[model samples]
Target chain A: MTAEPDLDRALVQHLADLARLHLPAERLATVLQNARRIVAAFGALGDLPLESGGDPDLQPVRLRTDTAEPPLPLDQVLANAPRTAGGMFVVPRVVDG
Target chain B: MTELWQLSAAGLADQVRRGSVSARDVVRASLDRIERVDPALHAFVDHRGERALADADAIDGARARGEPLGPLAGVPIGWKDNLVVAGERTSAGSRMLADYRSPFTATALQRLQAAGAVLLGRTNMDEFGMGSSTETSAHGPTRNPWHRDCVPGGSSGGSAAAVAAGLCPLAVGSDTGGSVRQPAALCGVFGLKPTYGRVSRYGLIAYASSLDCVGVLGRSVDDLALWLAATAGVDPADPTSVAAAPTTGAAAPAADLRGVRIGVPWQLNGPGLDDEVLATVQTALATLRELGAELVECSLPSVAHAVPTYYLLAMAEAASNLARYDGVRYGARRGEGTSCDAMTTASRSRGFGDEVQLRILLGTFALSVGYQDRYYGQAIRARELLRSDFARAFAACDLLVSPTSPVPAFPLGSRIDDPLAMYLCDALTVPASLAGLPALSQPCGYTAAGLPIGLQWTAPAFGEDRLLQVAGAFAAATDHHSRRPPA
Candidate 1:
């Protein structure tokens, strides 16, 4: 069971970094192994004619009226926030003073 | 001689409407059934008898006041934990939101609740609809009612097991791939994944936004038909939902499939298919033929690649859909780090289960810059070809049939370690999911091991009525659906 060229650990690690997930070295091996098998599963698509006749059109549009509505109460909206301060979500500092 | 818990949604609704059975009686029966069976089955996770009984009492009060009741009046139904119900804990079977409560209700549950369906509680599922077996749930796996050692095929295993074990008359599950249909097959119950966009998905926590749909599980075809009809209309909240022709009316399964054209794909046979499942499906097809259906052989070549196409596309969408879970705004926070990125990554890695993390990485791998065209682009093209194949087949036949699952309810933990083998179980059910067609899994018969075997049928987009009609007809002609698991 060989992995496709791009299904290696380096590629999966790169993908993890891009996706902002923290995968430990041990976990990376298992994830990469399964990812390779996944690639193997769909590898046949590589040879299919690229003639895209139909669009899967992943998302459908909803037509909403122009009417405006009230947003949920600020208190209610922030209730589930893991960290909140001064009526705003408090994320770790991304900027230096 | 049927216990109140054993009645179908329609039967209980009719009885409640006529005052022959009180709503409290129905809800109490469901709660008692849950108490007696759920310890072993683990079908339901978050539940409160007081809340359920209260809601049931309200329905009874409405009846006493001479008010009109919704079609699902007094029907005890379970909502898959992923579907938010304002103020209810919707864990989505993940540790991230294990204690999270919703501020709003999903449109699907809202519609069903409005129609008088009692919320029995939240049913378990594969974390974020990721696994084929319920083994992936953070809460724990839900067991098949037929054999406790086997899985109740998931990610909708809880709902299916609930229905099969007579814990509830109906339950709602989200089907991104074959979640609903596959579990329904394993549990010897009826499950339906409507044509994509046929049901509103406003608050179904997105797994794969494009393919995810609100699906229903029930013991009787009539209940599922009603469940669909009540919730299938377009909603402003879910732009993906379509305003389609109603799904059911005068809802009798046709006496026979006299003029129905059922297409059996040549792809149904092959290496991966189990011998017993193949034989069971063949017997069911023969029954349809005896009912006068014209069975035509069809080809869907792209379906051979459905697993990859479906998984690739689903994983990609899931990767994007799940991005909102960073710990700053919602869900539990996992790590303390100086920078937002550090905290976010730690939270996600700690929050998600192994299966969810693996998919996110695989999805990211497919959509990464250099390989986007090679994997993501080709998978989308594969999707197009699959849709075209379905269209061509439909041009010749009104319906297509396959085994809902390529195998029966397998023993728990058999494929948990091997994700690929577990994913391959979805081979038969994914074709319809990828094509966005309406499909239903009906109990055809059982294997010698006593596990349920499902017979599936796919109808063109918005062909739910036809799917129901045919399933109902078959159910009417056979006693397979009525067989209960021994105590």
Candidate 2:
């Protein structure tokens, strides 16, 4: 009965930040406008009632059977690390603990 | 040498089998062609010239010893960068994996190699196969061979362009949405996306798991069929791989479409399609009707929702699949940063292109707990409706035909700023992909400006054999598929 929702610039920027996208500041307005347009275009789905039935299409996430295969050598696994110390991939500590 | 490069895969194989042309000669000609044209096209991302020659020479030696070789023996084919080849860098046209090499070869590539096909090189593609055109590729765009200033469609643009420019007679590509068909149409070649699960997906870099299909680009339907026969089959390694008999034998040469029922959906008859493209498809339909097929006008109202459904589903799947690229276990790693989380964030920020990042964000949002039912769940329901629409249509008709793309290849940067317009280009092709049906794009005609237009034929799941038969019949009746762009 009502018009579908739209995405705003703030929302687009939030998504971009979450995705770690480096969109140029100059292009944000245009990207946001286009994103809004696309979301609006897809709003037709809101008119349909999709809640009547059980989720027949729901698929279970089948985890692969765990096997005790030999692990890769620590050196080989860390070979491509940008920085390493004491045979471990080193990174800046975030948590105080 | 020129003639050899222009020969269809079947023609080349026949000649080599009869000893009229040596395997070495064909490989040499292909390598020479790549050397001559690829510098400008940039179709190939990596070259294994010496290795390809060695493979060809070994095939020739086997032939001399009176040993039989595979059907496509010694023919050169380019692999799209997303398919892993053991010991070769599988970059997916991204700097994130620029130095990363796969320890395993794609099952499809391995099968092609066992069939004696020479690996020409890896071709360019969109970064993570995200964009409609190759402009989003970190390595740069692959130009349309028809008009260098125009674009070859993506994310299989490089493979399509290479086949069009005579860099290779055939190439392997992956289609999600319209990646294979759109590019092949833009470049004026034959591309086929077999029914989902027909080809193994093992070792292919996943973009959208359910939507991705490995496809083939070739100069002719016969060439495509040859590649399909070699690569399509069940693989225990890929659970989605179907356990069905191969369908290559159904591609018998047929001259008429008698008794075939063709459905033309009305939603595909909209204003976004170019006038010339519509005319070309209408003419093809008229010709098919004249040849004795019944043309049924059908309404697929649900098709209007196909593009959005595809995007939401694909982006959600892509977000989940690409979460593995967090700069820790594999691929490009950023220097030590404040924390593991910070390092991954910065690494992905600098690594993925704008389009890839955008989809990842959109997908993550769609799958977020509170929004899941509102977005991702609704999209899935829409996809089911689309599938049911196609299934109902197929019950009344044997095949469905539509224009491969709404418009012919637009200027390279025309829609770069307008993502909606760009996404609309795949409107017609997405319905078939959503339904997991097989589809083929064969050159139908040229635009008034001389760019190529494609006529797409789609069939139900496991209907590739029938689709190929119809396409082969159509190609035989017309010369459009044989017309090459003047390089």
Candidate 3:
């Protein structure tokens, strides 16, 4: 082994929290192992002689005209919503006050 | 008589347009073939027989009315589950969106349908195109048509399997990394990942947006050429789509590769390749030499950094893309009596498979506090190196060749539990993906045990015409492509 991962359980939990995942304790163990291995494998990139230039963004971002086109109909947009009320998505209350 | 389902897309379309075979007959034959073969392979998620038949009948009616027929007239094909078909469920092989119906169709599919192609069904894939093998599909794994126990590579495994098993003449799959080409190699078919932005990704479910490409898998280069010709062009709806004229269907392969320079990358073929696979590819290279193409040795040393760069960028994008799968608008939901954040978390926990979750977590870490530059940023820099490496190599060679997958199809369950091992399967494929170049995989030869080995050919961006021409030539000179798998 090159080196044991510098990761620990709290960091794993923190990552899950950031990603909005609630993986179970047992699954976390496996994620811990897999995540560490993947990240470690990422260490291989350091071996390359890389030159950073020109924003490193290969995709060209094209902007359309300023005029707005009609959006998807509200009903069509809400077609897949599990819960809807008054032509809008229904979700748990965000603020108690 | 050749079976209707067994004909190439171009061949079948020609016959249909000539009125010798009705579109309905082609659709029926494809559906019947799927019925006969899909049980063993699990290539499809939902059968759209009723809708497909209706579409086929429409095409026939148009023909009867003497209306101009489109290029893909009457050809039946499969779409990977990640692409949207209005009024059809696009699960992306995940339970999260199992009940979701697309409000609008993808632009690429719209183009294909306008060209008179009948959509037979939505094919299976890894849940959200995460896994290299189809085993991560919430539905089931798609078995290789060549061998039942072996895998059809993923996340486009089902599309590849359907084409290989003669269920459809052509299918559309997304290649984020080697999803399309790897499965194509394993299943013994032609798979093409066109240059980035060559095909619109408007309706393809995002999986690592930068790297994901809407690819095609078919039985022949002509079929792939036909499909690409129909679907490739600028889409105003997709901002990233480039303005390129649609390519014509492939001409017949040339008599010899007089001016073609084929590069054999030392980085692509080296240690860890199966002995049989290496031998089969070497034999294919010898065949190329006989066709008058000069073989040159080239090195893309940065290719060694491809896997890590691809994963880091793909995972970060996946994390951002999949963030839309909250319980609010669509997909599976949970946690009824809790706050929105809690409910969303619970729903995602219940929805995403292990592999997807792990990637998201890893991606989150890479982009997290203080680590973004070390992981995600470094990966981008490495990607630039790979892109330039290809540029330097192409300056000398007309095209490059390698085995699509280091080995043929592995056993279905062999690497499912080992994500790293599964990631390594794309060792030869991801480099082209990272560079945004056009690449195609076609059946070149077979291993001793009868598994197929694929010959991968890649050309510079927007070089699909030349790529198809070279592959078509190689296929014409050798009969390896004509050897069909026993479904």
Candidate 4:
């Protein structure tokens, strides 16, 4: 099955990049092929009369009384960090000149 | 000999409470059953044998001391790998967290443990609950108990197979889009996805946050009720959890469905459904009518679009929820890149399987600029329509009925290459999940090939009691649920 040229293989690759996933060239062909089909199927939503009915309000308000509670221990909080230094999670430097 | 593993959760609990059976014996019997059946089934990935026996002994000791115990005093149960057990490896069936351990227990498991249910182990699942078959698990796929060559439907296949094979009396699995119910249907067991917010989602690693719910699978409706009673309640940890009391009373089997109005959706019976499965569901509906239910025709016109809507919305949420899994956190890390972005990309690509990566890409594309309105916005609107459709249908009927899946369990690897075909298997089950209604799948009958066909009953939110009452009535009247898979 031919992927609709309009869906753009490059665009899907850009999506993979945006999602921070590195898909090899071989997998990209299959991903693009499958994604276009899926996206086209999802296009069925266009058939619905979404113009008249406003978006549903699904968000619920949850408020609690301000009360003092014990916090998690710093060690426990840092327990899962892949890299830690000086009592904090260590990530690659963000501010590179 | 009829072993303790063969008894239902309620029976085990009652016997243990009355001192007729010791908890250690029950645990040992379950452990032995696991040893016998799980070799071919691959239902469990982590074995908590020592802890399970210890916990069981504590139950026996507590009984000796005359301490008060909960109704599920000695029931052995499995926790689907997605739910955390303190210090236990909860991979969510993924290689990313294959070695990651949790610092805390999930609220549902904590509740069950508090209620005296013994944790047998962590069951297998599709990685991050993404696939329709257990084949996606990093550990390995769990096979159906009925026929070892077939898949136990997933991503809750492990829990379903465990219960069906008598490895445990009850197990907890999360249903994002029919994860729990689909597997239960295929495996010929009882599975229930409670009202979305009825059960707490605390420590259930997110699949699709809005749709994910912790569900239970068991051999009998009574056991399902008993398991739900132990776990359902609000938790401060889960803001979405509703403030409803746990449903404690198991509905006794009604002699007749005197006032029950069951609606059958005209859309469910279609070319997509297997002939045998459809006929079995029809017979089950006939049985319900014989039991005095008033069957009415109902239409949820939006249900035909459920798969696309559910995938779009769920994948979008999944993409966002899974962003926390960069290499800097608790999961496996790869690539010694100088830049954080490079490291993250490498880690994720190396960590996730094809299915997970595909969804993330699809979700990213849907949420990207210029496409959000056309895809994400429309999916949300479609969800609203589906939810409203269910509400309107419920107004006309006390409950709705449908075949749990369009077909019985397909052979292993049949749909692995075809993503769309696998997604379509969830056609009937997804409407209930997307609507956040309480739905249960029970063994209505089986096919000539000995494959089970599940009959699903769905009720409006918080209608668990009425839902189980009708299911219990049907189960009490039929012998379908009692047929065990051949040894």
Pick the TM-score winner. Answer: 3
Q: Write the per-residue lDDT of candidate 2 for residues B1-487, one digit (tens) a residue.
A: 4488898888887887778888889988988988888888888887788888898899889999999988888888998999998777889988888887776789999999888788889999998888878888878888888888888998899999999988888999999898999999999999999888899988889999888899999988888888888988988777788867787642785678899999999888655788899999889888888878889988787787788889988989998898887777677776464567767877887788777777787787777756677778888888777777888898899999999999998888998777778888899889988888899999989988889998999998988888888888888888887778777
Clashing pairs in 3: none
> How well does candidate 1 score on lDDT at residue B328?
80
Model 1 complex DockQ against the native: 0.64
Candidate 1 has what TM-score?
A: 0.97
For residues A1-97, could you state the per-residue lDDT of candidate 1 as single tens digits? 2235756677777888888898888887888778777777677777776666444344333456677778889988998898899999998878789
lDDT of 3 by residue, A14-87 (tens): 98998999978878888888888888878876654445622445442456668888899999899999899999
- The TM-score of candidate 4's chain A against the true chain A comes to 0.73
Q: Which is superior by TM-score, 1 or 3?
A: 3
Q: In candidate 1, what are the lDDT values of residues B66-147, reduced to their tens digit?
A: 9999899989999899999888789999999987878999999888889998888999999999999999999989999999
Selected candidate, larger TM-score, 2 vs 3? 3
Evaluated at residue B275, the lDDT of candidate 2 is: 89
**True contact recovery of candidate 3:** 0.70
Specify the CAPRI tier of model 1. Answer: medium
Whose lDDT is greatest here? 3
Of the candidates numbered 1 and 2, which has the greater DockQ value?
1
> fnat, candidate 1?
0.79
